[model samples]
Target: MESQPHNDRLWIKLLVLLAYKTATHKHARRLSWSSQTGGVIPISPKLCIKATPFTQLAEANAMRFVAQHTSIPVPMVHCAFEEKGQTYILMERIEGDTLAQVWGQRSDESKARILRQLKGIVEQLRRISAPPSIGVANVDGGPIFDHRLPRKSSWGPFATIQDFHRELRSGIDAGDIEDDASSPGVKDMASFHEQAWQAPVFTHGDLSALNILVRGDEVVGIIDWETAGWYPPYWEYTSAKHTNPRNLWWQEEVDKFIAPMHEALEMEAIRRRFFGDF
Candidate 1:
């Protein structure tokens, strides 16, 4: 289940649009009105003059992190600047259609292709040298946000499916998630494999098709890693399944994605710079 931090994020988006433009029907001068890229047309290259402050910083940080470390595909940030009341983030536009919209319109016939592409992207991100972590708050003297616990633990004391499920269930109840959205509350944390899996190399917090760019069966570029976090590798499995063509509430999809990749991820000795369990 997702944290309802920005439970009405889309509504906030709408409100932002309304404030920027008197009418909601038309997008602003810097428009991504539609990011539908057929193989024939490319993704647009334009400055998002009014990109949110949070998003602009995240995009800039992600691009910098990618350039400094890994080569896995992600958009390149041209520059980030703020002027007056508007903040601008310029990025290299990927040349493929967004997987999210495409997947929704496709029948089950396209589902296999979507999953394969998704799997491939997840695999790519998993190969990164460092999982994203700031060690604390972004700015010096800012609020300290520690993901590490007092006891040394890989993936923060929860690596197996049962443990993951329990934590997720706790979140659902604590967050007061609706019944339809909560996980089935695991009966035993020992039922699933007890082996510890590696903490996240870099889990894209938001793995929706909207953040992905696909060309046929390949994921050319994953545009947004704003919500990317450091945690157990299996966390992405839950996230990807939710954004799939058919959103299977924790029951079917999350476990399926992890079962296939668990063996490969667990045996490695993790080396992360300024990375703490999340």
Candidate 2:
């Protein structure tokens, strides 16, 4: 029997398919589903479309900015349009295997090479200067603050770091609590918030193995720029560290792959614990 969630997903897929069909007159025979549950649907071998209720304008712009400013490989955006209250983005389908697909079979040397490449990419991203801010970037390349965890809801494009930390502290206080010993509750959001962040820098915002595309040993593309933004220096590290990896090795050595932000990561870990993400 099909599980409830599976059935729900199928229904949503069907609705999306119908919508796409009506809009584009495309045939399902040429279309396929991506591993992602919603929004992202493959329309052709060399192209895919991502549909979202909220505007994906920021994502589309982010990709262009990254490609232009840095050598980081992001998918080429062919088109972006809004229809029926959803934003649809058609983009190039990168021809490569996701790092997650090949990580386990890779030799230690290959893994190290990939890590080095990623570190270089991170360095490049960090070089993109931005006006001081503590949240996602808008289409104008200005700061647009939004909730960091559990949701993408907008909050404030805070002018000061203090304002950003105040929002974070509030979130911590209202967040759920956990009983695990390894998972500690954040007892002092005020004290925790006192730590100063270096100037804001461009961030990919979500850096998981699955989002990294590799052809053989070289990284060919980095997909999903929806969360790309100008943020506090620690945002990239903490956000990347917020994942729950299926690969144990990834979970173990993630800190080594990217720049280390121990204090920020610890804060995120505590937040995740409170929210039951672990």
Candidate 3:
């Protein structure tokens, strides 16, 4: 294993110690500040907690599903509940730097190793049996008809790929595709809407490097299951690619790590162009 720098390790150890102390104190305010990924507070060396404005029951369930059914490295959900308009999740804290933080510092061989692990993880996820519906799965393996969107309101637990596609084109149906229907992207969406998709499968929904934790050449954990659900097989590739479209390096990461779904990406690109305003 390629170890993290000595100073980084020391800093992490210190944080863990402090967090452990706080958690051990029975009445200590359960608060540790993190501005970037809001409401995540390290509670202890072994556990962390997250408080979010949105409901995290789904996220907790998703993490549990992955942890139980697959060999994928993910945090163990200790407990999750909703309170005062916020959901709180307490989980195990897997220690590592995010792949995003260290990818550029790695050797090609290390990168390849990481990708192989991720490929195995994806294969395992696909092996999970899914129902006919296309949507997020509940804890008991039922579809959640209203899946939350990354940017705005919930969208689907669509019955089919066509239903999902129609939802994408709904902006035009609502007369909001764009200010100019003549815009090339708008016109492209109209054409792309007719494309078909393969049967639904389990998807991470958001699989950017930031969500993948790395320790040395190994993938220690895959985090952020908030958007995980059942979707068309190509959903993973298209969604990961969309995370940082203009960043050439991230594009390379998507290409190297995620199986390409050119047609799917093309359709997804069109959908975003059309409904992005919403």
Which one is best on TM-score? 3
Off by over 4 Å in 2: 1-38, 132-148, 171-189, 245-247, 275-278
Order by TM-score, highest first? 3, 2, 1
Whole-model Cα lDDT of every candidate shown, in order: 0.43, 0.65, 0.67
Model 1 spans > 4 angstroms off: 1-26, 29-50, 82-87, 104-117, 131-197, 243-278
List, residue by residue over 103-161, the lDDT tens digit for candidate 3: 88999899899999988888888888776543434333443422334344555555666
- TM-score-wise, the better of 1 and 2 is 2
User: What is the per-residue lDDT of model 1 for residues 132-167, given as tens digits with 9 covering 90 to 100?
Assistant: 332212111122112222123212223333354334
Residue lDDT tens for model 2, 72-159: 9888876665445566666787889988789999999998898888888889999887754444345345445334553445545566
lDDT, candidate 2, at 194: 52
Q: Considering every candidate listed, which one attains the maximal lDDT?
A: 3
Report how far off residue 15 is in candidate 2 (Å): 19
Indicate the TM-score of model 1.
Answer: 0.49
lDDT of 1: 0.43
